[model samples]
Target: MSSPEPRAPRYLVRRWGQLLLGLLLYGIAISLMIRADIGLDPWTVFAQGVARQSGWSIGIVTIVVGAIVLLLWIPLKQRPGIGTVLNVLLVGLALDLGLAFVRTPEELWARILLFAGGLALLALATGLYLGARFGPGPRDGLMTGAHARFGWAIWKVRTGVEVTVLAIGWMLGGTVGVGTVAFALLIGPMVHWTVPRLRVPAAGDPPRPARRRSARAQAAPA
Candidate 1:
């Protein structure tokens, strides 16, 4: 089913505001996961690893990494939208900002809670930004673009990329722990549950058709 149409002025306010808020939450989530010290997602793990080796902040590494990934999209003929650009800029900045205030807790249970909460927030952030319909993030675009260009299954593309990153990041001294396991298990379902409800209509997005008919009906002259 199509989303309800949201009108201008108010639409712009809600759209951009939600996008920014989502990005902010996403960055904070990344920071929380890092502070949790249990594990990190593959992309962040790669960033953390590179940061450790390069003596840069993880957030800086994240931005640099995103830009590089976006560049890869060009060869695949992917065009980035405003959301994509903001994803590159704001997420890393927010992460750094979050880190300035967030601390790693010593207790295991607290760390676990923080890690779980971070995952939940990340899922919601994803839905919010995506629902705004500005565009997909660099990483997501890379996957989708690859799928479009090479005709590889989405799962194949995503898995290969993530595994490669995870291996490289782990080799580079990024921490991988129970949190990683938790993320892998919970993220898909959590995002699935949240996205449909949380999504807002994107500007200029087409509405979904109400229903489908049989082949004969579909093939009939308009």
Candidate 2:
């Protein structure tokens, strides 16, 4: 009889589990922040704006926006991996689920807890998903693709796109404040702290080179 095929390495299984957890946490983080009501992050502000204009739920708008952004990847020849697909579907579902359970708190301290907790969770979520190395999300792809195709600096591309989105979303009445600024300033450090520690090495993967966030402002956390 032919020898049994070698089993897949254990780390692969762990990686998949981590990926799911990360995505779930990401969705929860978004819900917590929105419910916190202190502010909406930039991409989220865009989703809120579009939700207002289209009358769709924020989760639905988020999914639609992700899909549209994914389509843009075609011209750049960027491909979505398993992580990419999951990020699109799961984060929105989690957001809606979180919203269902979490009501807007009446007390200021409660809101503060939600905001601070959400920020930390979002950073951890970023590390889990990106470190899994399945692929970047639709929004991340948009930033990277623009930089590659246009030969613009990563920060310049990321900043221009995000600022424009923020403006449009703000105009549409998306809440903005301390949360927005905090997310903008702190996420890089947060992701920096978390990504390196949790990253799953490839099966037989070589010594890892430094991994950089292709865009300065990812703005893609759940």
Candidate 3:
């Protein structure tokens, strides 16, 4: 027997809830980064460094980075959707808010634990948010755009971007340490695991037409 079609309402509601929860988890992940005090994520590190050097708010720095990344999407023919815009704004705001209240851990072990846990949660949140299928994050969209335009492998493109950003941020006095390395290594797996678990509408659900019965063949068999 064929399986019944999945309900749209069930999928939509679950996706929406996951999106909200994902954002919150992202916020907590940033908070954990702040508390860890080892280092920020490469992108966040860049934003923080720019903020420090330019005397701009971290949020403003983030907006600028995201805007620049978004502009790259034009040549690649990737339109900015609601989720994309939200990701650009929300991530900065969430980071700023998280930093405001999250105090740095005093002990080394505490910091290390926070860094590992935070990195995992951040990856998980990214996957959950993306599973909504609304759009990709600005940085992610930028990487994808570059991959399409330059014909570079995604891993190579991503590694180059991360390395360049991390080096610049470090030169500008952003923290670069064990946490940065940990994030780079572990985030991919965490996202791969979490995204599949969040409920989203299946793209392969469209119905296929039933095959016509061959009357001659059927009569011979009977």
Candidate 4:
């Protein structure tokens, strides 16, 4: 007689949970930064620019942007996992929900606090999702795909892409301010610190190679 069906591995379930939670938190963090209205990271600036021009909400723009980026993955021979797909769908919805509930503050101190909280939350979320190892987000996948396709250094690819987007975003009237500088300065180190600590261990996991983001600014997945 056939035995009862085997259950899914607990770690698989845990990984899925972590991915979802991380994406949700990432969206909320983005919303917080937007409400702070001081500045935003590069991709968010791009989203804001598109949102401004298209008259769509930033969350909607985010989803559209993610989908578009995913399409670009095809030519680069990038394959996506369920985590990547969900990252595209879920983060934007969460961002909109978060924006609905969170309000902007009038005081400079309060705005600074909000941006700081958002940045911290964003860093934590990046660790959780990436540590799950389901897949890279669309933006990150693009950078890696370009590196592999062209044999460019990861840092060079990242810088070129971000600078291009930053230029377009600025031209499209997205906010560019101190927060943008702060994000560029801080996110790499923060992600480097958090990812190692938060990464989940699996039975057959391979040893990850050491990366030197300190020497080169390695932006986390947007």
RMSD of candidates 1 onward, in order: 8.1, 10.0, 8.7, 9.7
Error of 1 at 152 (Å): 0.4
lDDT for each residue of candidate 1 in 46-83, tens digit (9 for 90 to 100): 99999999999999999999999999998999999999
TM-score of 1: 0.88
Model 3 spans > 4 angstroms off: 1-10, 203-222
lDDT scores in order: 0.90, 0.87, 0.79, 0.91
Which model scores highest in TM-score?
1
Question: Per-residue lDDT tens digits of candidate 2, residues 86-169?
Answer: 889889888888889999899999998999999999999989998888888888988888888878888988898899999999
Worst 10 residues of 2 by lDDT: 1-10
Instruction: Mark the 10 consecutive residues where model 3 has the least summed lDDT.
Output: 199-208
- The segments of candidate 4 whose C-alpha lies over 4 angstroms from its true place after superposition are 1-9, 205-222
Structural similarity to truth (TM-score) of each candidate: 0.88, 0.86, 0.82, 0.87
The residue pairs in collision within model 4 are none
TM-score of model number 4: 0.87
Candidate 1: residue 218 Cα off by (Å): 39
Candidate 2, residue 120: lDDT: 97
- The true-versus-predicted C-alpha distance at residue 163 of model 3, in Å, is 1.1
Write the residue-wise lDDT of candidate 4 on 13-91 in tens digits.
Answer: 7788889999999999999999998899999999999889999999999999999999999999999988899899999
**Cα RMSD for predicted model 4:** 9.7
Ranked by lDDT from best down, the candidates are 4, 1, 2, 3
